[model samples]
Every structure is written in structure tokens, then in C-alpha cells.
Target chain A: MAQQTLEVLQSTDLKPKPDSSELAFGKYFTDHMFMMDYAADKGWQRPRIVPYQPLTMDPSAMVFHYGQTVFEGLKAYRMSDGDIRLFRPEENFKRMNHSSERLSIPPIDEDLMLDYLKELVKLEKEWIPTEPGTSLYIRPMIISTEESLNVAPSNTYTFMIILSPVGSFYKEGINPVGIFVEDEYTRAAPGGTGNAKTAGNYCAAYKAQERATANNKAQVLWLDAIEKKYIEEVGSMNVFFKIDGEIHTPVLNGSILEGITRKSVIELLEHLEMPVQERQISMDEVIAAHEAGTLQEVFGTGTAAVISPVGSLQYKDQDYVVNNGKMGETAKQLYETLIGIQTGRLKDPFGWTVMLEA
Target chain B: MAQQTLEVLQSTDLKPKPDSSELAFGKYFTDHMFMMDYAADKGWQRPRIVPYQPLTMDPSAMVFHYGQTVFEGLKAYRMSDGDIRLFRPEENFKRMNHSSERLSIPPIDEDLMLDYLKELVKLEKEWIPTEPGTSLYIRPMIISTEESLNVAPSNTYTFMIILSPVGSFYKEGINPVGIFVEDEYTRAAPGGTGNAKTAGNYCAAYKAQERATANNKAQVLWLDAIEKKYIEEVGSMNVFFKIDGEIHTPVLNGSILEGITRKSVIELLEHLEMPVQERQISMDEVIAAHEAGTLQEVFGTGTAAVISPVGSLQYKDQDYVVNNGKMGETAKQLYETLIGIQTGRLKDPFGWTVMLEA
Candidate 1:
């Protein structure tokens, strides 16, 4: 790989980092960030690492009104050997390009972007927390920066990556949480921005998520927009179900996010010689499986939470408990394996982990 | 209305305005703009009119990631007597409040907001374009300001109003245009942010807009997301069709914006003793009407385009020409009356125009 030189402006007065034990998801960030600019005439230019600070833009920036923005979430793990490593960082860049294309944004050179990311992470390696499930969460995003309020694609863009020291998703680690099935509010419709990890899709689900939280559920389980029958995702993660000892998930439809963690889970299952299949699992099928006592487990997979077990599902005024409102065996096993591989505690059988040298 | 004192930050250096003939939509802005802020603890703060400049925000602002933003568009017309007036300015603020609730953003006091708007408009009255078919476009928007990447409501918000001197919708004025029916891509579904004039809805329509432009059409005609048969909107406007001596537009569903211009058109139709019905009009029915030589006119109504006549429609390789691919009598009459009332050229009977004394 050709070495890309990124100009670094280190923060002379670094702010105190948050205590690892009290870290929340996406609340505390490191001292430096990666930023690059794009213009239609000049393409991408001036890639640099700068102090984590505020950005100023014309009040009439297109992103403020058009929502033409896409983002990716990944993490940097502090391995047992005291070296910072990343899990399938390339996948995030690849998916970022996919999202950029869908949002009519200019593409980023993946190799160069990965190099820039590694450089930033290496400089801020002190922020990665290795206590229990704590790690450094990496958020890379792009937004339209044209200083006008028109409906067309932006001629200027800003690609930025910021680091946040995030705690484990579950305080107790791999604990079960309840999810409310969202029937009234659909997540993504086909031929829409559903497959892309854009900002609008997340905004559209907030009301449903709020209602779910009001109903004492931890997350919202989204149904397909057209029919509202098929299960699409849970909150922002890909969902999988274990029914009668067989693992199943919704196939790669055009209206659901192709999550990296979801793919790794399927690959890990296949590697372990477990029974797994990808198909359309309708809500009716889920309910039927629950009634027949064959629904052994339901879990969500994402970069933030490797595996979040579903203890119960609330749908249409009916509550269906999965494994009696307790965590499942498969979920616990998968979580351990995923994080173990990520932190380099276990062997990298799938070659998924990328190690960064000090 | 309670009078509110707004802090003003006047710009010392004012850029030269663009030529009226060469002015484009949302390109050049005025010297000063209106702004206000909101926080969960403090609620809405006192409004301000600051110099038109860039806004500084943390890169991790919630709007960049979750897209929790809403905006409204209206216009100010300089009357024949040189008096500046707004066309239902209060309605925009009222509708904005509704949009704010739908997106889980905080609401502004409509009366105080109106006062602030009038005060700002009064200060920048020189930017209001007075030429025929041209007016000053007013855009009021609210965006999340919290610098966090969580998928929740932002605790802080920035509400700003910017003005752009725009040229006429058509250089020739009230010309007919063709629209391509979008069958594959969907706009908004039920229980989505369609009825609200939010940022995401507009962004979701961009790809379809690009495809329509590529197809050599002026705009895209959206079909309902569920069935993809019922006509939803034309571009970002409410669609109305004249068939068999009656006017028909899609009824207000949960997934279609309640256009202010649409409401006025319906009221104006009633005042003129025309039979108008707000009901679902399927594409099949439209095709049959065109084949029967009864589809007299098709037009779209919005704040930007008062009335856009539909010359023809391209759907599924079939072309249905409306009014022989020419502007019809009803559309011409509606356009004339709408602009006439807006500019005080015709008598106002509905109390729709808000007069601002210079």
C-alpha cells in the first residue's frame, strides 16, 4: 500500500479523557479527528488530522436541509498484547462507498481512507479502553457542504472520522433486552434508502423508538414498509432467530442494511458447522414459532453491540417471551466468540482481525 | 401578539446583490437572517437577527447523523404600490410547528415567530424581488444542534430563517411541463415523515428527481408506497387533475404533505363555483380519462410553483397527454388568480394575504 501522508495538527492542550468505567456509547471522544474535503472540480483534497473541534459551515449548507449524509460505525479494540487493532475495518469503508453512491455522493478511495483511519487511530491509541467490554468506537461520516439550499446533489463535501471511547452495550455484558415490534411505522421501503446507512432512515424511526422505550422496551423491531409482515431489523442492527435449533435471518433484501456483524455471525455459524439459513422470516412465522415453543432465541447483531439477545417481543398487545425472559446459550456463545476474535484473545480462524503495530 | 425584542448583529460588509435577470433559486442571500435557539431545559429562547454568515457546530451534531431537521418555504411579493406582503406567512409557522411535533423537535411560539419573521422581513425588504413572476423566497428551518451521535432527539436546536431573491418559476411564466411517474422508487409510507415538511422527505425524493430529469421530464410524479397505484404527489407539490368537468386531487393521507398552496387552490375553486374533490386518483383512471378526451388539465400546487400545468405524463412506456400537451384554461385561470391575489392585483376574499407595512 502506498503511504498517504496526512498533515497532523495535534491538540496541544488535550482534554481529560472520560473514566473508562463511566463511559457511555458515543458520549466521549479522543483528542484528534480525521477530515478531508471534496469539490466537484478538484475531487478529494487536503486530507489531514486535526484537533477534535467544532466545524463551521454556511448556514445554508445543503446537508442541513436535504439530509444527504451517510455514515459508518466501527471500533478499535485494545488487544491483550497492548496493541490497538481493528475488526474488518475495510468492510466499513466498502459499505461507506455503497452508502455514498446511494446518496449521490462522490466515492472515497478505500485504501487511502483505511490508511488515514489507521494513522488517526494510531495517534490516538491512548483512548482505546480495554477494561471489560470497553473499546474505542470509530464513526466515519460524509455530508454535503454546498453553501446553498437546492434539491440537487452537493458540489462540495466533507468526510470526517471521529473517535469515541464507548463502554459495553450492555452493562452486565450480553444481557437480554426486550424489543417492541414496530407495525405502524415502517423502516425502509424497497427501491428506497433502506439498504444504505444514511441519516434519514435513522431519523424516520425515532418516533417508533420513543414509543417503544415508553412501553418499557429496549429497542424497536422494524417490519417491512410495504406489507409490514416481514422482519427487517431490530433498532439499527440485523436480527437473527434460532428456531428449533436452526439459525435463520432475513435475506439480503434491497430495503435492509447489510450489516458486517450480521455477515460475520452467519460466517461464524457456518464455520462452527451450525444449522443456519437466510430467508424471509415473517412476523406470523415468528409468532407461530413462539406458540409452538420452537423459538429458542432472537438476537440482534451490529458493530456497537456484537450480539444483543432478545428476552421478549411485544407485538400487537401480545408479549412473547424468548427463553423465559433470559439470555440464550447461542447468544452468549456467539458474543464470546465475536469479541474474543476482535480483541485477539482467540485465534483468528476467519482472518477477520487486523492488527496495528505500535 | 406579544412583542419580542430580537438581538440584531448587523453585517458591516454587504455583498452586491445578483442581477435580477440572472438570479437563480436559493443562490444569493440577503445581508441579515433570523435565528433562535431551543434547549430542553430553557425551552425556546429570545429570537435574533444576525448577519448572514456561517454557523459553527460540532461535527458530531445529531442532525448530521440522525437527520432530525424540518424546514418550510414561503415567499414575499412587492405589491404594485411598493408595499411588501406575505402570502399566508402565519400558515408556514403553524405548519412548521406540526412538522416539529412529528419529528420530535421542540415547538416555537407561532405568534412570536410570526412577529420575528415580520421584523426580519421588514429589515431586509430591499431584497424582495418585484419583477413580474419573481418574489423573495423565504426559507425557515430548524436543525438539531446536540453534538452527539446517538439516535435520539437532540436536546438543543437552532431555528434560522434565510431569504433568497429568486427568479420566476419559468422564464416564460406559467409554461406547461411533463412529469415522469415514479413506479419503482417510493417516497414516504404511512406513519412516516411524509406529511411533515422535514428534510428527509425532500432528500428521499432526490434520486427520483434525477431519474426524471434524465428521462427529459420536468418532475417526478410519485405513486403511493403501499400499492404503487394511487397518485401521491407531483415533485414536492400536491397534484390536481381536471377530468369530466370536475377537479380531483389526492385526499390528505398520512403520507402526503398538506401543502398550503393546495388548501388555497381548493378554497379558490370553491369560491369560483367549481366542483373540486379531494380523492384518490389512480393512474388507470387518469389514463382512461385521457383516452376518453375528458382529462382537461393536470397541474401541481406548491409554495415555489404556484401552479405548474402538466402537459404530459410518461408511465410504463405509455404517454398520456393532458389538454393536448398544452396549458389548459382552468390552470391558466387558477395561476392568474393566485398570483393576482398574492401581489394585490386582484381583490382578496379569503383573508389569505398577510400585509407588511413598509
Candidate 2:
């Protein structure tokens, strides 16, 4: 197949960018957005950067009826040197293809997609927030556009990359959050779409999140669907538990999302000579550790929240507080280091950050 | 709450309707559709019947990214006496609300929704197919319209009812279908959205359906996610088996859909003095029954097919032919009775059909 050329249509009436302080996650969009279409006969074609606008879709579009969609979340940071950098964007595209495979949607050329993304970021460089924790959130998504009610794979799709200027995820500065251990609701199972970065997987957890909120918790800690025993994920992020002196996380067991930040965290820990084990850590083990005074810290990792510390866990009518309801020493250190590397304030030892040309 | 009034807007340009032979499932649409909007503060409002057209949605609508949507399917029939009839549409609306509750979507007033449906169906009565086994398929759906990237319930929603003239589900005249037993992928787990008529639940089964088609089977039979032993559903329909002259179906566990047809079938069986059982039916027990020649017949029930006979079961590299690959007597009876009642030909003893005023 021939390489497709990027077609750019700059917005004629560019809207004023939101003030950095007023920016919330996914609230303020940039003037221009990237879009691509996929037809079964023509492959992915008509890649263009168009003005941000509403989508005109047939009411019978497959995405609205069958949930055949996949999405990736990452950010473009404005470095102190006035250069824009994206943290492991190639990884997001790669994982996106994986998610598309599971959702039965056609894949895009990852390298070409990344090139298009960089071009978009470079064009909208002014939109990238330079605040200490704020950056331009990049949402790459694919939705089935076939106007059919058939419960099958769609013949056409729409892939879009929309940029949003956002404030820091930790609006109150990385404070530890209380989690509700959900036993009544299941996010994913071993043979389901849990691992895929699909829309269904995220929305399916809304009920559990509501229950958590009702219980006065900030987020939910989901357990396995079958046994409701082993740890899976916390809210939308991959979770980590510091037992004794080592970091333990649930293995990528078919159902758990292979979060890019989770992978980077493991690699960073290994580089720093800190112990990290990826295995099935059951709730029993976590509770036992908490009782034994060995459960030092708990945190979640994802593109949205690079490092979210867990202060307490509510499970089976019992509350288990961790590290005195405060962010742990390791969480603080990792958060700072990861943020430093992402913002280009520190050296990129793993070559994880990709710089956009001026 | 005051009952909302429905506004009707006739189509100025009506499209040509397809011939009876050209009628296929959900391929063609009617001239007008019913629509309603729901806001967190205003509830469901502005119910209207407008020209069938495309929907203008924000690119970042929650349904496209988070799958916060639900849908229901039923049919309208054009009776021989020139009257229009709906088969258990009230049940569909009720179940749709149940599905909405599970997906964290606000429920629509079932009575008011049904009134709107009747108004729309009455307006498009000409679209109802009159051919034998043909009807106007009614698809009622609710989609989250909030333009947010957050992984939570949307504050706004769109509810729509689209009509499609559909021919017989069995183009080949009610022939039995071969079933592929899916052991690798799961449709729904105990705590998942399996019972909800949500978009995610349907699309998540696409991969398994593809596998079934590749194996030269007509449909897939899903087992429980936890054990992969008990039969859950067959190609989006409730499954029934006959062992030693007794009708048995999987109980309405949290993972199994509460199919209206399944319920009616059980009721009909009991009225006919046939022994019916709703309990967990394991694959091992099924295989054992087949070995003993007691597995007389197997079939599936849903709004589309009414009753679909299972000719064969492919499991563990072995094919268990049911009733010598022919439609069983009971399945034939149920199909004719259900179709007859739905089409207003047979006596409506159970009052399942709702007729629209001329």
C-alpha cells in the first residue's frame, strides 16, 4: 500500500484558547482536530485535519447501537524550553491497534498515525498548557460509522484525534484517595473485553463507581469477575500495592488493561533497583498485609492520572487505611520523577518522550 | 410528573418503500421516527415524531467513547383485517428501562414512552410488512449525548425509535441452524452487563460469532463466563433444550438476559401442560443426555426469530446432531403459534398482542 499524504485544512475562524487556569480535563478543545475515515473497500482514507465540530451521523450508525469503538488517551506537554513533547505516543497507537483488533475494527498504520499526530500537535502547539501539571490531553478514538443495525463488524469507521487543554489531574495536589472494593459489580472477565481499550469496558464500571461514591469513596477497586477475589484494576487505572518493601501489581491476565503507564512504572522501578512483582494479588493477601502492617502504599497508574495514591480501602464493611491516609514516599518520588521526565525537566533515560519539531 | 405530549411532523419527501421480497432485517427504514431528549434537570422532554434523518451529535459524545447506551427490539405487524398490532411492546419498554438502570442511564416513563411508540407506529402503519412472517421491526434506543471524555454517566441522552420493514428471519423457511459452542470467549459474566440490552453486550459477542461462522456453524452458543459449562444464550437468544420430553432452559441468572419470548414460551408450555424447567443446564449434562439419546431437541427464542431450532451442536471437536438435523415438533409448534398470535391470525388467549387503533 502507498503511504498516505497528510491533508491539513486549518480553521479559518480559530476560537480563543481557554485560560490555563480555567481549563478542565476534556472541557476546552483546540481550534483544529484530526480526522480519518475507513472504508472496507478503500481502507483508511481521507486523512485530514479539520476544524473542531459536531459529527453528522446516521441514527443507525453501528457505534451508537453496538459499541464498536476503541480509544487511546495520552498528553502533549509544553516543555520549559518551549518545545512540545508527547509521552510514549507510539505506545498509545500500538495499544490502540491491539484494542481495535479485539473490537473487530480495522487497524491503522501506527507509524503514519503517529506522524499525523505529531503534525497535529505541532500545528496546535500554542494550545499545549505550560503549567506545572497541566498539558494538552490528546484523545485518539475510532468509532464504527456504518449506518446499519446489524450486530456485526461495521464496513466503515471514523478515526479522530481531538486535543483538549486540561488542568492537573491532581487539582488538590496528589492527595491519597479512599477506594471502595467492589464485589457486587464486575468490570471484566478472563474471556471478555476487559483488556481492550474499548468504550464498553469503561462505561460498564459506572455503576460500581456510583456505588463507591455513595459509600463516600472516591473510586472503586474492582476484583475478578469469576471469584471476586484477585485484584484487577482501580477505577480506570492499573493498580499497584506496596507490600513490605516491594511493589506488587496484578498481572496482565487477559482481563486487566495493559496500561502504558503501568508498564513504564515497572520499568522505572526495575531501573531504580526497587522490587516489583506482577502477579495475581488477591484481596485476601492485601487485607492480610494491611493487618500485618506491611501494606505500605497503594496507587493507580494511567494516562490521565500518572500516579494516584490510595489512602484507604473499604471492603466487606471494613476500612483499611494505608500510610496514615497520605501519599506514600515511593508514590511521591515516582510521581515527581515521571512528571519531570514527561515535561523534559529531567533526562529521558528510556527514550520514552518524543519531541515535536518546531 | 405531568405526562409529556408528542409532536408529530410528517415527512415532506417520503422515500420509496421496498418490495416484500426486498425486505431484510434492519436494512430499510420508514419515513418518520420518534425522538425524545433527556436532560439531568428537565428529565425526558420534547417527545416528537419527525422525518427520519441523520443525527447531529458532538464528536465527543459519551456514547461514542464510553458506551453509555441501551436498546430494545420488537415488531409491529399489519394484520389481515387491516389493523396494526404490536407484540409485547410494553414488555420491551419495561425491559429497556431495566437495561437503562443497569447502565446508569435515567429511566424513561414506560407508559409515556409506549404512548409515543404507539403514535409513531400508527403514523407509519403503511411501513408494516403484510407478507407472511414479515413485520415492521421496531428498534428503540437510548444513547448518551453528553460531549464529555469523562468515564461517568452522561447528563444528557437521546431516545429514538426507528422502524424497519423486515422479512422473515428464516429466509430458507424455518430451517434448523448448526450451533458452535464457544468455550474461549464469554458474552457476559455474573456481575457484568450480560442481562442488559446494551450495545456493549451485543458487540462484545462479535468475535465469538465470527468464530462460529468460520467453523461452518450458523450461530454460537455461549456458556457461563466463570465455568464455561452451563449454557447461557445462543446468538442473542434464550436457549431451550428437551431432555426426556421435558422442556428446560437456563434460569434468569444475573448473566442471562430476561428474554420476553423465553418468558412467554415457558408460560405457553405450562398452559399446554408441558413440563418446563428453568435451572442451570450444564454442557456435561447435555452431552450425557445426548449420549443417552434423551436430548431430543434444542432451540433458541428471541424477538427476531421467535423460535429457532438448533440442528446440531459443535463442542470439543465433536458435533452432536439434534433431532437428526431437523426442526423438532415442539419448535415448529411454538414458531407457528407465536407467529400466528403476533400476526393476529391465532386466538390471543394470553393477551400478548397490543393493537393500534385505525
lDDT of each: 0.90, 0.92
> Candidate 1: deviation at residue B283, Å?
1.0
Candidate 1 regions off by >4 Å? A1-5, B1-4
The residue-by-residue lDDT of candidate 1 on B1-358, one tens digit each, is 2345689888898878778898888999999999988888888886899889889989889999999999999999996678887999889999999998888898888888888889889988888888898899999999999988788999999999999999998887566899999999888888778898887787778889888998899999999988999999999899999999999999998888999999999999999999689898899899989888888999999988899999989999777778878888888999999999998898899998899988
> In model 2, how large is the Cα lDDT of residue A357?
86
Q: Tell me the DockQ of each model, to 2 decimals.
A: 0.76, 0.86
How many backbone clashes does every candidate have? Answer: 0, 0
The sequence of per-residue lDDT tens digits that candidate 2 reaches over residues A1-358 is 2488789998899888888789777878888889999999999998899999999999899998899999999999997688888999999999999989888999899999999999898999988989889999999999999988888999999999999998988877778999999999999998899989998998889899999999999999999999999999999999999999999999999999999999999999999999689999999999999999999999999888899999999999999999999999989889998999999999999999999886
The parts of candidate 2 lying over 4 Å away from their true place are none
What residue pairs clash in candidate 2, if any at all?
A: none
Give all TM-scores, in the order shown: 0.98, 0.99
Kindly list the per-residue Cα lDDT of model 2 for residues B1-358, writing each as its tens digit.
2686678899999999899999878889999999999999998899999999999988888998899999999999997678999888889999999999999999888888888899998889888888888999999999999988877899999999999999988777878999999999989998899999998987898899999999999899999999999999999899999999999999999999999999999989988999689999999999999999999999999998999999999998899999999999999999889888988889999999998996
Model 1 misses residue B277 by how many Å? 1.3
